[model samples]
Target: RALAQRQARDERADAARLYGRIATAHTYAGRYGEAQRGWRAAAAGHRKNGDVAAAARALSELARVQEYAGRPEESLRTCQEAVEWAKRADDIRLQAALQLRLADTLEHLDDPEAARLHRAAAERILEEEPGDRDPEPEHGANACEIRSAPAEG
Candidate 1:
């Protein structure tokens, strides 16, 4: 956290990335409040720095943190916002992943129909990929794998 704050004084984008790493650590430690604050700052900083894709990724993780904190309503809203950012970033894979995540949150909220729709949308997105497109890397199958930072010693 101190490192991220220090970086914030000079490099907004780098600070956002550092905050994201701290947020991931907080999430693993079950420190939901700190995790939420870190992720929100990461998302905001990324957005302000004109890194929409990074902001989308941060928002996606924030939604997961919200869900883990038992705030499904907030999770749903955050997921929706993440989806929009992903779209703006022109990252189809991330958008599809966010949709699937939104589906999971909907299911947790007892909205199975909505969940099903989101699942179908995600499937459709994947299916719509052109045959010539490059295949996703082995780890790319999981959205969380896309942005998760390596654990620091």
Candidate 2:
């Protein structure tokens, strides 16, 4: 009761995130229908809030759930829509990410040729993105420590 009241009071935008969280929980709980509905709701809410990234992310989640539910064709379509939303957001990294995902889903949908094309597109973007950008060195390294006993006199 108290928890429900608190949930009801959550900000609408934040509630979108909550819906995605609940979707994940429901999937883990083996509640396929509930998980999917939650993900769809999250996508809708984030879209309404003008958060293209969040909306695409939720659609991607929904795609994954549809795959888990044994609807690979639907998953493929859903993943393609996710990629579309990602493109609308103009996020290159997200584009590469979702292109890869949608490509894989197409593979499962028995469209290997389309999958290859999508994969090539993603690879082209990733390859072209770094041509002018300088690469950064790795941030951390493994250091070795040595202990020496006092030298014998």
Candidate 3:
């Protein structure tokens, strides 16, 4: 945290990345409040630094934290905002991944029809852009795998 603050005083972009890492650590530690705050700061800092992709990713993580905190409605809103940011970033893979996440959130909210629509949208995105693969894994797995997993019977 101190290092992130120090970096914030010098390099806003780097500090935003540090803040993201801190937030991820907090998430793994089960500290949802700290994670939420850190992710919000990271997203804002990244946006202020003109790193829309990073900001979108931060928002995505924030949405996940909200979901983990059992606030699916808030998660849905945050996920929607993240999808918009991903669109502005022109990152097809991130957009698709976020759509899948939205689908999952929707399912949790008892909106199966909306979830199916989002899942189909994500599939279309992946099909339309065969060459676009995310360089980094999202949520500890391949986005495609997340999208394509078969339902448990």
Candidate 4:
């Protein structure tokens, strides 16, 4: 893995892609922190390489890992950043992906309004997207309905 990373660094575009692969592997290995760090590096590299869409894609994956690690708030922040990056890149596909991520995170955080907003955004974007698309598959389905946030204890 170290050798792969070194070789990846020799080429900027390849380095960004390798960092994403390494980060995914780290996530599979149950190293959330390491994966998050690697994803951050990948995001930075993508942004520097003028691939804002790719950067947003990395951030979306990082947010997914964060959500799996039980950090909903952090995941939301990361997803929001990814959404902004995607919008800046004018990549509708990436924007829809990020919206779904944010929606899933918000759903877990008990922010039904925000989650619904993102869900609608995702649906709208997916409607215009070419080819077959399923938003639910891309974004995890919610365990609870989006009625409203329950009262705090």
Residue pairs of candidate 3 with colliding backbone atoms: none
The C-alpha stretches of model 1 lying farther than 4 A from their native spots are 1-9, 131-138, 141-153
Q: For candidate 4, write residues 1-153 as lDDT tens digits.
A: 653776655777888888899898999998999999889989998998999888988988888778767787888888789889888987766676677667767878888899899989977976886755444543444211112123246
* Candidate 1 least-lDDT 10 residues: 143-152
Q: What would the per-residue lDDT of candidate 3 be over residues 1-153, giving only the tens digit for each residue?
A: 675576757888888888888998999999999999999999998999999988988998998888888788998999899899989998777888889989988988889999999999987986787665555546434342223222334
What is each predicted model's overall lDDT from 0 to 1? 0.83, 0.75, 0.83, 0.77
lDDT of 2 at 106: 74
List residue ranges in candidate 4 displaced over 4 A: 1-9, 128-153
Report the Cα lDDT for candidate 4: 0.77
TM-score of each: 0.84, 0.78, 0.83, 0.77
Q: Which structure among the candidates has the greatest TM-score?
A: 1
- Model 4, TM vs. native: 0.77
* Candidate 2 local lDDT, 1-153, one digit each (tens): 432554688667877888888899998897989999999999998998899978888888898888878887887788788878888987666676677777777777678899799889976765766434323212213111111112234
Clashing pairs in 2: none
lDDT of 3 at 6: 63
Q: How far off is residue 78 in model 4, in Å?
A: 0.7
Q: Write model 1 residue lDDT over 29-146, tens digit each, in one string.
A: 9999999999999999899999999999999999989888888899899989999999999887788788888888888888999989998998798778555444653355444433
